[model samples]
Structure formats: structure tokens, C-alpha cells
Target: MPTSATLAQPAAKPASRRGFLASAAAPLIVPGSALGLNGAVAASDRITMAAIGQGPRGQFVLGHFLEQKDVRMVAVCDCFAERRAAAKQVVDKHYGNSDCAVYRLHERVLERKDIDAILTAGGDRWHAVMSVLASRAGKDVYCEKPISLTIAEGRSLIEATRKNKTVWQCGTQRRSNPTWKFVVDVVQKGRIGALRAVTTSFGEGPWRQTGVPTEEPAPDPEVFDYDRWLGQAPWEPYSKLRVRLWRVNWATGAGAIADMGAHYFEAVQWARGNLLELPVEYDGAGMFLKKPGINNIPYFYNVRARYRDGMLLIMDPAPKGVRYDGEEGYIHILDDGRVEASPKSILEGLPDLSKLPPPKGHWNIMAPHIRDFLDAVRSRGTTVSNPEAAHASHVIVHAANICLRLGRPVKWD
Candidate 1:
């Protein structure tokens, strides 16, 4: 739903052996001013990092990492030649250094022992694989969600990160929103009284990439790496719309249910503190757009996820926000940045975190979430949205998709 007000502001592939080794091993030297004592704050303790996937989203995240002092962009990798060069240009211009390397294969970037962490967005299907490989490479990971294409993949991602003992962050950045967090506290802290059910409204269809033609076109494998872009996902012919925004492409993503659902779902998981488990059942129905029209992804969906506690999560397409109904009253967190309640007094009486400090406005929603990840990378502490929690949220959304596709309710363990 891109429900976070901050997100309302705006809006990759792999590589080879010798080529990979050379590209990944590129220099990640940190400036002396950023050096601190025990961890990344100090000169020698700086975090040398690589960015995988150089699309708009990839570059968007790289923009965030670039502004941080103690972190170095050692290398940039992507399937697209233009993106690879563009990302490197941004980094080089910022640092006034040409040491940053660009690579077609992310494997080489991972192989580099010099990199301490990675900020990656390698598409939905490649998420688990990219993260798992990075974890195994002894690097901390900041991955965009939905974290996996399937429940099994999510499980594997969790296990891999746990085994590797690496810091992991799921890019459900709304965890940093004070108002969102306050609403969750209101629900869980009994301020709402005897919670009954939760309702989520997210826009349907990520609407295929714009300016795309009606038919598939000849792909340039050399420049775009079509095969690598599709990766292990169900194969589809090269289409202009596919890679532009995989979140809307069924071959690469699970549609809007998983796209916008990732953010709104995390709000539910956070409020209920149900990040480690999924609902007991799923009942969903949706109609998809005709293939070759506005992309093959589904266009509309209404799903109900029933929890073990008899709480129902009603998901719809609209308005884009989370609503909680309790015996006493209902609290609605609207995407328009307003917190409404049946009894305005309820919210009026409750203390909002606005006064706590730092101020909440614009600030690019990912700032706090990314900040949390960086801090954890230093302290080795748990992140607000850890892999376990992220996986659980992904499972709920994926299960909803499964239910929609099957045209029947599903039983969840």
C-alpha cells in the first residue's frame, strides 16, 4: 500500500568467477574522519559495503547508504550496463574517488573479503538467494521486502542468517514511524480494549511498467542480462515491463498483494507482535487483469486471515491503511497521515510520541529503518524488523496470494 506517509514521496542481477573475484575485491577504503573506537565508527573500523542491483530502487537505497560517513561503497553490481555505470558514477562523484568497482555478477562482490555489509534489492525471487549468499560470505545484509518469493525461501533465509550470525534488516521501514508505532502500542497495550479484528486497505495492482508495448521484444542479453534478471523464478519471455518494476510482474513478483502488502502487513505484524507465526487460516478471492494488457498481475483482491486467537485480519483494496476494531472503539491509521478513532477522545487522551524529539516529517521514511540497521551492524543487537519477523509477515501475504489463486480457503499451520 506504500501506506507509510514518508513512502508517499517517491519511488538488478548477477555475474562470473575471475570477473567476479576482480570486481568484488575492489577497494572499500573509509575516510579517516569516520573512524571511531570499537566498531565501524573508527577509521579502520569503517564498514566497507557493496550494493547489489542498480535499478531505480537499488540506486534509491544506495543514495541513503552514500550519505553515511563511515561506510564505503566498495562495488556496485547489476545486470544492466547503464545502471552499473550510473551507480558507480554517483558514488565516485560523492567521494571524488574512482576506486569503486562495477560488476555484472554479484558473486564477485560477495567474494570480496573486504566488504563488511551489503544493501541489496535483487528482486523478489532473488531476495532469499542473494541474502543467503551474502550472509554466508560473512556480511551483514539490508534487504528489501517481501523478503522471499515463497514461505520455504523465507524459512531458508531466516536459517541462513541465524547460522551465519549476521545482522539482517528487512526494509519494512514503517517500524520507524512514531505514529504507526503509537497505534500498534495502543492496540497491544489494551488502550483499545478487547481487540476484535484488524482491517487493511491497500491499492491493487502495481500497474505494469509504463511506456511498455503490448508484445515481448527481442532482449539484449549482453546489456540487460535477461536470464539473470529472471533468475530462478518461473521463466517468462523478455518484456519491457518486466524489469522496470518487478513488483508488478507475476513472473518476478506476486502482485500488489505482496508489493504494497509488504508494508501494511508489517504494520499488522508489529501491532500484534506476531512476527514469528502466521494466521491459522486464509480466505481470499481476487480477479486479475488479462495478460498482455496492464501486466499479468492480479488487479483486485479481498482476503481474510483468521488468527488462532479468533482475531480476523480483513484485507481489502482501497484507502491504503490499517484499522483496528476493539470492543471499546476503533482506531484507524490512515495513509493520509491522520490517526482517527471512533471516540476521538481515545486518541486525544492517549500520549502520542510526537514530543519525544527528533521530529517526524518527510525525512525519507527509510532513514530510521536504515539507521537502525547500521546501529545494529555496529552493536550486533537485534533490529526492529528482524528476519524472523519479516519472514512471518511475508508468509501471511504469500498465503493470501495462494488462497486467491486457489479460489478457496487455506489452512495454515
Candidate 2:
């Protein structure tokens, strides 16, 4: 593994393609389509990109990137051979060429000077570390949610992106949903009156384990690099269940709260106008599986947190989404893009959601969010789900987890 100092060293700048073409001894002819003719974006003008982690979620997001005309995905990296191959096939098919490169290690992808951005959708264990490394390599990042396994890791990612002047967009796609945008607008515009409390739901947790996992022989390195897949996670005996269900394990993932909580919390923060702030106090209780299997995360939890301004936030396993309560009325934003409100009048003046354009495709509701990141990358601007907001959201969940594990209240600084 490379040290932070080594990876953080500034990468050498690469020569521009136009400059190289200009200096070529022989005159090379190129297709008009390659130079932005016939409504196609020019190769030099497109954002050169690569992807790390080609699991189901990763591939899903990669599909969105493929839809963008201004994004050129040149490479993909994954520890699993099948995943990388599948991702490469998709990329190649989209471009009608076999030019998409594949690698098992992410460092190889990061070393490419021509790549301007990276899309990291690996497990929770790899999110922060990979983003930090990509930032150090001068690559903008679009990372999946639950961006860190711990508060410290989240903080490190924020610091690295800031130090490297990287543009990062966390995968909290709800921020781009029209319903959510309207919710934030309503709250911020004081339609809900002075916001007093928020109740957000992140679904149920891991199942209880009944038996211990037996150690098994690891797979061949070519098939799956188990060691690299674990990344910063502690070494554990090779077990298929561990890899398949990493979210239930403490060492590799942070369970339901960190998984879904990231989205809900970010929504809460945005609606409350506290994107850069964290709660000052946290208290929670969790029901952990008493069995001795690999699963250690809680099966259910309820957390109560308070911001410095006395606003209350509650995280629980019910309600299916987020609900904001104010002095006058309350508004509820459901997980399926449905919005409900009390006294009914609070929703009267809201925009007609039915008239807005629907999501592009199945499971591609995040298209707008992805577009936001790519636009920011091109213009050197900030994204809605930027690193600071991501870190703050991660800290909220990690702090709640600590309180639950300690069975005591935790005071934040």
C-alpha cells in the first residue's frame, strides 16, 4: 500500500493532445466526428475519466456517465475480474470500440496523467481512502454515499480534497431530486414556519447471525484480490459471506445508519440550512445481534441529536423517509419521491412535480446529480454534495454510532 505522503505528491502534468498533434512529424487525418463535427463533442473538449470499483452500484453510476456526451471513460479498475470485464464491455459497447482499458488495481488508473476525473463506488471501506488518493493525483471525484467508515476518515478526505484543490461530489443524489429541491425551498422560504425538528428514517438493519463463519480458502488473485478488496479493513479469515455481506460487519461497513443515513442526513442538513454544521450532541440505542457470527452491526437503532441552535434531529427505523416539523406545519418527503404535508395548505403553492421531466431510466434518478458533478468539473466550481457537506453528514452518523455502542450520550465539539 502506498503511504499518504507518497500519493499526495503532485503528479506531473501531461502534454495536451492538441499540442502533440501539432508537433507530429507526419500529418495525421482524423474523422470529423472526433473533432466535434455532426453534433458530437470534440475529444479534446470532453472530460477524460476513469472508474474505480465496478460492483453493481458502481456499474449503475457508470451507466449514467456513459450517457453524458462530454465524458470520455477511458479506463476502469476493480479487484474482481468479472466486474472489471463487465464494466469494460459496457464502456466498449457504448463507444463502439475496444478502447476501454481495464486494471485490477486502482493505483494504475490514478497514475494516468490524461485522466481528469474518477468515479469511486466501492464499498464503504475504500471510499475515503480512494477519494483521498484520487484527489492527490489531481483527479476530481464522484464518490458514492456513506463516504467514510468513520469520522476520522471523513475528516481526512475533506482535508486531502481541500489541500489538493479537488472538486468532489458525494453520491447523495436526493439533493438533486426535484421533490427534495422543493422541500428545501419550502423550508428555507419559511413556508413551514421556524423549523424546530426533523425525523428521518434509514430502513432496517442487518439480520442476526445464528452460527459462526468457517474459514475458507481464498480465491485465486486473478479472480478476486481479496486482500486489496479489504483495503484498510482489518485482516479476516476468508469467507464468502464476509465479502457478500460486508455492510453488516463493523470493520468493513457501518450498517444501516451509515449506509442509508448518509442520504437522509444530508437531506436533513440541506432542508435545515445547516449543510456545513454538525449536531452538538448525540444519543442513541441499538439492538445488536447477540449471536457469534460475522455480523456485528445493529439490527435496529434510534438516535436523537441536537444542533447548537436547539434544533432537534431524530434518526429511526420507521416512516420510510424524512419529515420536518415546524411551528406552523410539517412536511414529509418519502423515499419514492412522494411529498406529504399537514394542514394540506403548506403544499398548495409548491411547483407541479408531475410536469417536470421524469428520471432518465430505471435506477438512474441520479442523472441530474451526476451531471452536476461533471459540470463542476468542467467549470472548476462546487457541487451541491461537496466534500464539506459529505464530511459533516458522515460525522453525524459516526457520532450516533459511537453513542449507541457506548450506551451513553456523546458531546460534539
Best of the candidates, TM-score: 2
What lDDT score goes with residue 43 in model 2?
A: 90
Reference-based lDDT, each prediction = 0.79, 0.86
- Give lDDT tens digits, candidate 2, residues 260-338: 7888889888887778788999988889877677777777888999999899999898856889999999988777777
* Candidate 1 global Cα RMSD: 9.3
Q: TM-score of each candidate?
A: 0.84, 0.91
lDDT of model number 1:
0.79
Model 1 C-alpha lDDT per residue in residues 1-413, reported as the tens digit of each score: 33222221234135568888997899988654565634435657677889998778789889988878768887888988898989999999987878687788787788777789998887888878899999999999999877887889999988999999999998887778777787888888877788889999885445534345345775676588988888887666677755565666556776677876777778887787766656889987887655444355556778999988888989888877889999889999876556778876667667764553233343245677888998999999999889888887888888998898788999987
Runs in model 1 with CA error above 4 Å? Answer: 1-41, 208-222, 290-294, 352-363
lDDT of 2: 0.86
| CA deviation > 4 Å runs, candidate 2 | 1-29, 205-211, 357-363
